[model samples]
Target: MKTGKRIKGLMACLLVTTLMIPNVAYGSQPPYSDKAIQRVMGKIYEPTTVDLTGMKVVDQAGAPLNAELKFMLFDTTIQEYSPEVHANNGVLDTTTLIKGHHYILSLADANYEMKNKYFTLDATGELPKDDKTNKNSDSPERESFDSITVTKREQTLTEEELKKVNRIPFCDDNNGAGKFVSELSGTVDMPDMADMYINDYDVKFKLVNQYETVELTVDEFGFLQGDMIEDLNYAVVMETTDPELQNYVLLQDLVTSKNHQEQGENVLTRTYTHYTCNPIGGIYLADSSYEEGQSMIEDCTYAPLPSYSKKSTLDGIRVFIDRGRKINTDMPGALFKVFRDEFVFNERVLEETDEKLVMDFDTINMHRDEICKLPHGDYTITTTLPTENEVQAVYNVDRAGNKVEDCTFTQEGSNLSIETTSVSLYNTVIEFKHVHEFEKIDGTEPTCTTTGVNEHWKCTSCGKLFADEQGENEISLEDTVRPLAPHKYEDGKCVVCGASDPSITDPENPDPENPDPENPDPENPGEGGTSTPGSGNISTPGSGNASTPGAGNVSASKKGATAVPATGDNNPFALWTILAFASIAGIGSVVVTKKRKSN
Candidate 1:
């Protein structure tokens, strides 16, 4: 036993000595130094420096990298990892990365992107096989450090960056998939409702009354969005909330038996769906199929009613069933009128509703790795998204996160769209004011005096009386002002004043320069007036003959006992006879004087 123990001890010493030879004998090696890089989830880290300069790789102590973990590469290792990198398919297998080489790991579909094209030299070197084992390691780590260079690292992503890189829009587009249904129906029994896929009704209303339904369909921009419909299915039923086929039977019967008398009492129902891009309007079938829906065509005739049927529904879109159809452009004038009215309502409601449900989808779609797909070069990335149209905006968030609210990058479904058009603010202003004109406006009726011309006619309300001192067709204002004179004859003289009423007021201080005294109204022509002598007090007869007053007529005296005739023609008959007698006496006296003188 003693001999055995000595031999065993010698053997152990030999084993220890052999293990120490590599570290001590290799004088050019560094002092017991080693390095490692920790890789996780296909990502590599900076190499960890360990004290392995004076030791072999097998002598690594307190290894940060576990020996059982995958060892990608070493310079002298003769092992190879299987599975090559495939850039096209984005598969990063063990063969994609050289073992023991510094590399970067990224979470992306591009993890399989191949490195720059380079040729591999066949140096007749055996790469380390990972499953191989020596006395120290049974399955050695595959090495890549020998021929590898860490020139540059591919860009890596954070958790957030990873989300951006891997995100794809899934069901982000609002599939306006429920446009075939409705919540409200109308009161008109239009048989087209069957072709319109109307099977239920929520609010049935009276005829000609309005009912609105909010349909979700692709708008003019051609994407799923909210819209409105007005009176699509006119009915006159006391509406209920049933979705059965029989919900519209009574109305259908009335419509099938349509007549002028039947119209007042008939009703129908429809369960409205959100509207669609191409509205489900009228349909046309071959004229031969008239017998199929003859009752509907003949009875429920708005125009020359054509038959129709419900066709296939593709992705919730109800395509029409125009079975062997022909064009019906001039279907009927009356039908066109109804269609025009309803279409107006339809467009109006759509315009109003697009503004209400204005939220768009682009604000949520994110840009991804594909954005950087060009050749390696400098670039600046931006993102955009959309918001609600409750506010008028030139800007919005785009499919990416950058603020592109300017709507430049915005597409149809990317913005809160109002409609195919921009709606201006509706402002109806009505102004009320009296248009006064100093004179009558051209083409305006010339107003005349409303008062009557009869002598008894007076405006008792305004306290105005009419005058009958008549003219050819009018009366003078002076005559109209006061009561008319009792007689109509003048002093056989013509009047110069036509209708002007001149007031005769005496002037306080008469002046030749000013026509009026007491500052009479300038508009009045005769407020202050001048008077001249007439027949009274100074009237002379024809050819300067004076008129003497008689006893009862009353004469004036000029300081005389006997009244002198004021007229120059005043003469007495006694004065005339005395003169005659004096002439005879003078003749006789002359004759007598001559006879006496002769005696």
Candidate 2:
């Protein structure tokens, strides 16, 4: 038994040791440790439980509220408050809370009065009841909270202020009536209304009489209600106390509308729907008695009606009178007149003028520039020269500055130009050449007696000559005298000169030393050659007298008479004649020989 007791003691010792070691196993420990509990306590505190059913709330109208109601909770224990909790339809229910915590509840709304209540929540949940009555019970009574009512009031104006309003004068009016009216409108804001309301106010229209102020009332939306009278002045004044209301008051002038009748005398109305609050002051009417206001006046008068005369110009014609160095002195004094139909519209004397004559034409029913045109129908320009001077010639000059004679003028309506001359004015120069008498130069005829040169005819005015009439003619010495015929000899007897031989006899006149042997008569052949009948006295050939064969000089002894040869040892006429014949025959023989050689 002792052994058993020792064993029990050992088991009891192990049990004490186990108990002293502290329970640290996973399943043996509490669900939460003290450190974990302290950490949770740092994050959150205990809340109070309170019932909010007894709290009362209402709107300004003091009826049961149907809006969202909010409540705020204040905890006395933790010295902190909770976020506001909202209740729909103004009803609050039970809420969780902390024991032994002092709490306060409050509601805030702009449309309603604020309410506050304080109560303590013991360990048991309980709340204090609201004991306040409805605060709107003693407020002023209203018909409906949704809309407000407004009343109209009219104010009178003084006489001086009425007259200060400007009226439309008769002079300023297009139609002869002097009528005027003023129109005005504005916007106002009503309670609880979001947008601006237009033309919703009272208006007081005032006017000045002879000595007093008169007022007209407008009970409707403050617009000018009725038509105004003709030629009447008016001013508008608005009355309102609302901060959002605008005043439209102005001095105006009005006239009658198209629909207004004269019998009704209704003035026109103009509506000004948009306006501001700035005050429009008094008006001032214009004085209509000024002289400038008259529509019609007297005509103006002056000495000369700004007269302008007509003139003409020759565009391309430049008259050079003296050697192309000076213009004609009488050209400037030339007169030009223009006529329209049968009436003379313009006339001008070209005095101290250049080639161009500019004039101002008094056109009765036409333009001045148009009336200045000449030679078209009745319009003409006639140039009158001085009595002492006349236009001798109207010629033009070429590009080389040379005179072009007989350049006649061509008239196209009134435009005159030189024919075949340049059309440009600068390229044309008109000249009036001087006229003078000229002497004719009789030409001499060419002479055949001697060598002479040709003579040409010429004029004295301008030393110009005609073409050559005759060429030079030379005289031949061989042709100055008659030539003797050549002698033909047969059987030592001369045939032409009736000599035995031409070399030994004279043929011009028969003589004893030289005689015509062919004519020697068989009877009386030695009787000194009895004189042939009708034959002149025979002499030596160079001595004289060879009678012409046809002048009834002939020898009766011979049928064919032969003349005596010349007596001179050298007869120049015979020698020259022989030489000429020989030359001719020699040339003919040369030509025949050449021809034969060629053939």
Best by TM-score: 2
Across 383-426, the per-residue lDDT of candidate 2 in tens digits comes to 32222222334443433556543445544343333333221111
Give all TM-scores, in the order shown: 0.12, 0.14
Write candidate 1's Cα lDDT for 1-599 as tens digits.
Answer: 00111233443454344334442221222222112111211111122222111111111232221122111221111111222222111111223333332222212332211111111112223332222122222224332222211121276445564433311111111232322221112211222222223322232322111222223233233222232211122221233464442223221100001011112323211122111111221221111223444323333223311111111000101112111111122221111111111110000111123222222211000010000001111111111122232233333222243443233222233322211101111111111121122221122121122222334333333333333222123334444333333222234322432332223323663453464554344443222331112212334455343432332222322222442334345456767999999999999999999999999
Which candidate leads the pack in lDDT?
Answer: 2
- lDDT assessment of candidate 1: 0.24
Worst 10 residues of 2 by lDDT: 318-327
Give me the runs in candidate 2 sitting further than 4 Å from their true place.
1-424, 431-436, 440-447, 450-457, 465-599
Total clashing pairs for each candidate = 64, 27
lDDT, candidates in the order shown: 0.24, 0.31
